[model samples]
Target: MKLIRIFFLCLLTTNALIAQTISGFIEDASSGERLIGAAIKFNNQGVISNRYGYFSIKVNVEPVRLMVSYLGFETKEIEYTITKDTSVLIKLHPVQNNLNEVVITSSPKQELSSIDHYTIPLELVKKAPAFLGESDLFKTIQYLPGVQAGNEGTAGINVRGGTPDQNLILLDGVPVYNINHMFGFFSVINPDAVSHVDFMKGSFPAKYGGRLSSIMDIAMKEGNLQSWHGTLSLNPIATRLMVEGPLKKDVSSILVSGRSTWINGLIGLGTLISNSENSTNYGFYDLNVKLNYKLSPKDQLYGSFYTGHDGFRNQFKFDNSVYRFGLSWGNATAALRWNRVWHKHLFSNTTAYYTQYNYNLSQELTSEKRYNATTNSSIKDKGVKIDFDQILSNQNTLKYGAGLVHHTFAPENKSYQNSRMDSTAMNTPVESLEWSTYLEDEYSITNKLKLVAGVHYMGQHVQKSYFHSFQPRISLHANLTSRSKAQFSYNRTAQFLHLLTNSSLGLPTDLWVPAIPNVGPEKAEQWALGYAFQLNDSYSLTSEVYYKNMEGVVEYTDLSAFLSATNIPWYDRVTVGKSRSKGLEVYLNKSRGKTKGWISYTLSKTDRKFASLNEGNWFPFKYDRRNNLAMVITHDFSSSKTLSFNFVYNTGVALTLPTSFYEGALPSNYVHDLNNPLLINYKFYQSLGDMSQRNNFRAPAYHRMDVSYKLTKLKVNGTRSWIFNVYNLYNRQNPYFIYYDQQKLKQFSLLPILPSVTYQREF
Candidate 1:
């Protein structure tokens, strides 16, 4: 006890010796939205802002030059005398010329201190050629290396050979369970309401858990602090409107945005013209709102909510019978958060959130005896998290956090009714509790070398069983020269939930299941090595190689039924396996000038093994591709007009098919009737097919080109713009899927040569 007391006393004495410290928050000057990953540099010491835009650093008690920088923002520099503890709020202004381009640049200090992180500006996302005249953020992200889209025009993404469920997507500190609408044609996020987006593929920090592949953090706009403003946009597929302003001047603010599709109305009009007996309807809508309040200088409060729904129905009547089919799905999320500046060198944030996702399918038959059937599935999450950031000294920073979540999983529920008073109902719901705590330290060993190390401990309780994991993370960065750096990282991650999907089309019927006693949590260990160099003032290059080993991966058995209105436990129809993936990626980016964009390429291989499947042999994963290439270029013709082009080429995905067929005969017993001198026997023969290994065949290569043009006009009230987009500019018949038709294989395509237009107005 005496020795422990002495150690703590010495620690306190050392901390008291520090004479100066600087701490504050960084935000956008116009929108009041917090900026994550902003760099603050002074001499040989620096620190990046946390996710909540808070930062703290200890320095010498003398005059110094401080620099603050972020992507797409003008750099800010100031001279300060750090004589005592100080606190300040720093806001950065947007660059006028680069307002419409997605700016991704690193500060001189951050260039050598960070790795495997990308910042995508909203303007750049809007410039990409839209799919069906709708600007989609997820679609733009798919153009980057190490990421692939599931279908021709879908928002589903597979990153580094991992499924979509492996990525943890957060919107304003709340997780979004289902981010797709209209059968994956578009994402649930409204681009007009988003302020900033950050993506991390490797070297995950200890504060982020519950996912294996990547993290996409999206920050929403905090409304305009200056005045009231709104925007209205229209296209063939959908229409969107956004409004934002201060409720009580600078003390409080509110923002609201909503989008809805008009395709169903157009279809109804067409039906009226044709005078058809059949009717079909489909539509989707989403709503988002955010409110912010400043109670005091040291305290702030925020509330955010999002809700979206998709519905489809088709009905036909022939003779005396009527058939009807319907499908519906939606997502709802809400979050409440509080920020506090506890001391000059310490900051904290606490958040409470709730999210729910549900989908249902129904079928009805109208006749003398009516019959009806329906299937439904849902998942819900409620959690609370508290995080703290403390600046111990100039060379050391500490981060720690803890969170608890309650998950309710309803994998499936079915009901059937008949006119004869016969009915059936099946409902099964499972509940679980998950908790985690993590701690990390960022230490500068020298002026040219730095290290970030951390550990996360997780515990889960479900079905009268308990599971725990200890995950470790480490990253190292070494400055080889003034303009080049080398980085290495290793991370172990754990996932307590899984998504059971049988189709590659990304349907809403996919079920989300939790880990139980019989099924274990999925775990992965990843290693990455990278090198980055600043070629010149306007260009940069980065290359990385990575490998991952995964265990406890789950897949459905051959006998498992999907989208069935039956009562069966999900856990009884799955098999656990193992997987591995390795890849190399190269990217070159130009951040300035009239012509700006990026070129990226990737080479990868992924395989899986299961003891009970594929004759115990290894097979390629379904989404694996050998090579991928992408190029995007945008040229500004003038201040009012711009042209952008994008090209992509990738090897086709792998699939499994039958190789041959054979005949089999069933045995039958023979009864001998000696007296009658006759014998009778029966036998049956059936055709059986032999299948090859899983994902043993690859489809044909796929490629496409897209181009767009934007024209802008300045108005007294606000701004107006017109955009023209052409998908599949070369008219390439890219295959969406391949299937066997009778004796020959056939390929089906979804989208063809298409052109669309959108008009926008802002005030």
Candidate 2:
């Protein structure tokens, strides 16, 4: 006991007496925008940069060599001789003569070998063929190994059997509620204003929470600090513009971007040109703005804002009566952040943010009798958070944070007419409080082994009930050889809110609800094991296997349950169940040279069990697919000419369909005998999808090919490019959905053999 105490004392005293601290920020040399996840190594030990590019570590208090590296950026080495505490700035330049490179990793290393994480380069995705010439961030990720899309040309993604709401999508460290537009046909995020995206499907970090399946952390460009630039782009469906410049040369900068679709505009114009009273319009628009200012070398502030809206209106006029209908949904979010380096060893970031999502519907009719109806549903959150990173020594790093959020939920359903009304809240307008705190440590046990251990505590209070959770996280990494690596991780995630979906169409009518007494919060546990090998200097391969289990998930009993049964409480109408998923994924990539691309494959299974719905039997989840494969290739014929191709194939998704026909029932107002004078003989039949077994029918297998070509010309002062693309080049009429019509099952497809062209100008 005495010797152990003495050794611990010596370990604590060694750093204070013999070592010093060195800290600084890493940034891009040309634009001065901070880089996230940059690596700094000294004597073979290192730490990664934070969200704001701040990094700190303890030195030996003697002359030493420091190395910094980031993907797609040149490596830098500095010779330091300082003996006490000091701070400095390090800048790295872009790689010479290399086009955009997709790293596809989350580890804080110089290699593309991360476990269950991906870093997607925004520019590289722009080179691929897009839907209607609009490059989307969400669609790019759907091509990964373990991700699945719900339908053809839809932006919603299902990760590892989890629902779309299970993903926590953030923009500039702020939460975004609605990620879809045009009834889930396209995503609302502007691709040009984004810098990059970090997607983590396994190994949850300590500072992230409120989701079960994945985390999408998106960052905005900080604008160029040395000059001004602008871009204008046009396609058949939408128009977009972006501008960025230095507000005060070197201290401040601003970026503004906006995009609007013209399909609905043209529809409205056509109706006006014909002087028609009846018209139909549908449109979507989004805006992004960002600002940053440097108060000093150690202090900086940033502000980011985003707003997007989608609206649909249809009206019909006949005689003296008119019917009108409108539906709209959108998301608005803002975040303000400050970064301060308290000392050479500690870095802190403080953030305050606000986010809201809502959908509204109105319908009215005028005639001898008047009818009107409206519904407004919304959810809002206001929160503040502070995170800190402390480098203790060469072997130990500490990370911790705390946050509090205020939530307001309003699920209102009301309809009134000239004579009667049915006004009742779906759930009610309630305010709640949510708070969380976490602590974690990343320790290098040996020169070739590392471990990350953490704990998180969270709680929520709504009405007269309060619920809390305790979760533990762990990760282990080993360098098996100079060219081989392996990793293992475990994560527990919980969600306090739910999306009440009554339709598979991803409509705006979906409602958001909080955890009630009977229905607890949704929880998931996942474990992953991965191995990687460097096939050569140009190619890399990785294989991963994962298992996940989810509990306390709730769903509606029927498609029309929402507002259909007002007498029964909403909570009572939902049924709670559990799910399980397991999968194996493989990926291969080529990262260097004029031609680069990747191939990915996944084999997976998922099922669910509910006592009330499926007769206590386990059945396949909607997204359960036995196989998925994707391959992509990009070739640069020259600097002025580039081409890309993508091919995707996946097993058929499961569906539910009626298998038998039943007899009709007599109408209430009809008699059995046709000769009766008082009434007539008639029959009425009612039928929908049978829910005896969940997802027992499978649709046809899906496969498609896409291609894009870019031709560039150098202008006198800038550059001009023309992009031509084709979607579903083979004209395959793949099944988007299955419907029973005329007593027969039919296949429906939305997009087929589409080709588009876009023009872009940059100055």
Q: List the residue pairs that clash in candidate 2.
A: none
How much is the lDDT of residue 609 in candidate 2?
85
lDDT of 2 by residue, 371-454 (tens): 887777899999999999887876788999999999998866565565455454565687889999999998888777889889
Per-model C-alpha RMSD? 5.3, 3.5
lDDT (Cα, 0-100) at 135 in candidate 1: 93
TM-score of each: 0.93, 0.94
TM-score of model number 2 = 0.94
lDDT of 1 by residue, 384-485 (tens): 999988878767788899999999999888778888765556655889999999999988788788888999889999989998889999999899999899
Alpha-carbon error at 250 in model 1, in Å? 2.0
